[model samples]
Target: MGAADSVTACLSKGVGALVGTIIAGSKSFIAKAKILRKTLGSGMRQVGVLCAPALFTLEENKAKILAEGLNKIKGLKVDTASVQTNIVYSDILKSSNITETHLCNILEAHRVLTMPKGPFKLRLVIHHQISESDVKYTLSCIQKAVNGFIG
Candidate 1:
């Protein structure tokens, strides 16, 4: 991954500096990468400045705000253990009668944006800007969306 893609938990496009390090000890790999990079185009500028916010966001949201916030929602099913960092994979209960696309459409209609991963799954990206109240509002909106689709 490029510098920006690794940082910001991949949220801000390619803005921040690189995230992790590669421990490869081969000059062959390095030389090949150097040649390949030309085809990948040039790097970013001022992305170093973006790294500060990206680091802060990753540190802040990853610890407490990710799955803990999402799992509290009422009709949504979240595998709490599967939540590793700032991403939450949401599943709708079969009994809820709401498809992922329908839920996402309803949520978007209510001004709450969501990304659908599959017919039954949604991918939620949590960031530092999302407060506890924001999570509550999201849940509330999801509830409303589900209600709209149910009837």
Candidate 2:
């Protein structure tokens, strides 16, 4: 083949490979989605509500709020040396008398939210449903609950 024809052939082959790869990837993604929907018993549902646009907007701002709230806690320390994610973990060694259930109840009463990681560890998660003020209020509630439990 001539030089120009060789270059054209190479370009056509590259484009063909790219198209094939994209088609295969799409098929794989569709298959995975089908399997997940069946497993979750959502195959019959025509509409799925993962999150609305407003909730998506809230989710985009959740990380900063979580970081600020985690910082406000006194003895509860977080690993901030690395890039932080949406979850916050704190050690409860200072509040030995505070049970996980009690902490959960205190959070419930304050309309905050948290979960236990272990005997002396607690985990907090920030989501689109929670606001920055909620985080601050939760920290305050935790502080008070811990003090009351210790005393």
Candidate 3:
């Protein structure tokens, strides 16, 4: 970050940090921020408990695992190379005879969660807690759902 640049990032949802954010910037910005923090009485204690898992999440390759599995499923298109993070976007093909919402519902019935981005686009997020086995199960469920829709 530049001398004038300041950034605030939330660690609650993706990294599994239930609460907390990181505020960082140049020395001048930090000096001003500290005074503001003191004025606002914003103090924290024992934050390492949440920070540890967030750190762990950064080191994980769970998103790649899920993205590769998604690429193998028929009637879906996933550019695995574009998966640089924990989010995977899959486009449902016309051959699948399935709408995004319908497919999302089917996956949800199988205890898998996904979000529909559009009529034929689905969004899946890989979190720190999702395991390889979970990815396999999710893939199996999606393959079955797509095949059922086409057949």
Candidate 4:
């Protein structure tokens, strides 16, 4: 396998292991919760509040939105090779003429949101509050701002 494939495989395995651990631990906790519920009369009430289904649904929806938005950006590249779970790794070339801080400022000014992971790296995420239009607008704004800065 090539370098990208190797990295992808490694990340996939690592993420799988981590997720397995979390699942096993959660099951263990559920057993304890069951015992506590019977002893404290808080079984159904507390478990209902957790809402694991809703949380998982939200996670899936957010991932879909993010994938759509990331594809919309022209110059920014997405590296799907190393992505295993919701976490995505991408790279921005130094020649892009776009500083990470400039992008951050543009997003902030537009009231959109993102996080910078490196000097040339940016991370945009989707959650309940963000929409597709917001992603498009943020990308347009970043393009305009970077062009203006370069000019």
Best by lDDT: 3
lDDT of 2: 0.56
Kindly give the stretch of ten consecutive residues in candidate 1 with the minimal lDDT sum.
Answer: 14-23
Q: Write the per-residue lDDT of candidate 2 for residues 36-112, one digit (tens) a residue.
A: 76798865432324223333433465555555555556655566543143556676655446777677777777777
Estimated TM-score for each candidate:
0.58, 0.50, 0.75, 0.54
Clashing pairs in 3: none
lDDT of each: 0.63, 0.56, 0.81, 0.53
Which of 2 and 4 is ahead in TM-score?
Answer: 4
Q: Is candidate 2 or candidate 3 better by lDDT?
A: 3
Per-residue CA lDDT of candidate 4, range 1-151, in tens? 4433111123223322212112223556767755865797653545434455334533445444454445455556666544435444345556666777777776687776668898788776544344557656755765665556422
Cα lDDT tens digits, model 3, 16-126, are 456667788888998999898878977657768867877776677677788888778888999989876578899999987888998888899889999999879999987
Question: Model 3, 142: alpha-carbon shift in Å?
Answer: 1.1
Each candidate's clash count: 1, 0, 0, 0
lDDT tens readout by residue for model 1, 1-151: 4443221134453212235222243577666665765568735466577567766655565524545655665657788787655667888777777788888877787767789998788887665567767777777777667666422
Model 1's TM-score against the true structure: 0.58
Clashes of 1: 1
